[model samples]
Target: MRLFAWAALAACICAAPTLAAPQISALGTPAAPTAAASDPQAAAAVRVAMRQETLPPGGSLPEHRQSGERYLYVVAGRLKVSNLVTGEEQVVEAGKMAAEQPGDWHVAVALGAQAATFYVIDRGPADGAATTAANNDGN
Candidate 1:
């Protein structure tokens, strides 16, 4: 009995290293669906992203006007955002936020020579889309 117990203990200890990390899945993967911040589509009626976005070192430009109301929440670093059409600019820090009005033209750049990240929450047209512009998701 003692020998069997010892053998089992040794086997268990040896097996520990072989244990693998589980493959985790969520409601969306940023732009895909798991988390809300990543899913711009959450505000479907307003016209937002259907998923999370990945930015490069320089950052990103507003591909399209958010069409409704939207806030950008910085996740990692700070960003310098410029409204191309209006020539308005602001510095957004980590854990801080910024916004874009409907039909506004904008662009974001990494601050301090470092990369920046943020999640966008877009709200428009009440809970449902009232017009084609607000409902044009992914636009």
Candidate 2:
């Protein structure tokens, strides 16, 4: 009886804040994706959750590879993405979206005064190893 009464009181208190604080927007949320929705290559397995990354003014790229394709949407500022696949480099500004296909060699440098933020939705790696941290994770 005591436990039940205490539980009811706790629930009531928890529910009381349902109408108080307003919702604040987060810059980005990165998680593993599910299902091979739009990518033709990822039609066979579940995709990983989307990833959101914010690169500072001097942010550089690491060597990594992913099995699924990448769809990157720039959320803030501008960036210079170099495609080493064909010796190509391009500038991607804010409000623009770009796709980096599988096995493409590239590097991204922040082109703005502050930081450049972007969100990427793509398939996860076939193996559990994270390529982004390949060189820096241990450091």
Candidate 3:
């Protein structure tokens, strides 16, 4: 019985598809212009960091600015992000992403009655802070 089981498992494993090279799948198409197009210094090498954050219903992040570019992907629920400089506001839902250029002042708040979970990727100068509080006058 053990030998038969081992043979069956081996056969199943052998029948599974194998990849000859890495496969790439795009998440979604960007609706707005990319940050790289406007930032001339984007090509410079920078430090990168990733983190996951969850906000309870109605939770909010204080207005702040990133020393580097920030990319946020919503894992669950909806998040409302407001850009102080551009006066643009957007709601990013699950499976959607938002990007913030360096020095762009913004704030985010969880929407709906459920907790919102998301992943953040920050890319900035090697010695710069990830985020800092925005000026009171939105400078």
Candidate 4:
């Protein structure tokens, strides 16, 4: 019985899908004119950019923020996030999404031993920086 179980486990392991390597790919960036009605003192041009980021276990982005909003879709593994502005923390698993409002500061930590990948859509001023360092308070 033990021998049979070992053989079965070996077969299962061999049949499992292999994890992919960490990588990043930029989709594209589109720009448009922003109306003064929406943002009284905003820049005339606005942009929307998309990209994918992958990280191995224990990888993390230090606390950061952007001039505009960012949306994230987790493709694999789990994302552990801590928001400094709201003092909230949560783990976003695969198949879920997380949104960060304009100028929302936060830290993201990848969870589990397996690798993780997520798609990020950033919308902001045409010339605004994609990400900026923020006060993480030692996170």
Q: Give RMSD to native, each candidate.
A: 17.7, 14.6, 12.8, 15.7
> In lDDT terms, which candidate is top?
3
RMSD of 2: 14.6
TM-score of 1: 0.51
Count of clashes in candidate 2? 6
Put down candidate 2 lDDT per residue, 32-53, tens digits, no spaces.
3333334534433333445568
lDDT of each: 0.50, 0.51, 0.62, 0.59
lDDT-wise, the better of 1 and 2 is: 2
lDDT of 4 at 90: 70
Better of 2 and 4 by lDDT: 4
lDDT of 4 at 47: 55
Error of 1 at 22 (Å): 42
What is the C-alpha lDDT profile of model 4 across 1-139, one tens digit per residue?
2343344334322322332211221112222333422453443344556667888898987778776656667778998866677766778898766666445577788999977787766655567674544665633
Give per-residue CA lDDT, model 1, range 11-102, as digits (tens).
32232322421212111111222222344443222233322344667766554565444556676667777766667778877766566655
Residue 110 in model 3: lDDT:
98
| Pairwise TM-score winner, candidates 1 and 2 | 2
What residue runs in model 4 are displaced by over 4 Å at the alpha carbon? 1-44, 129-139
Clashes of each: 9, 6, 0, 0
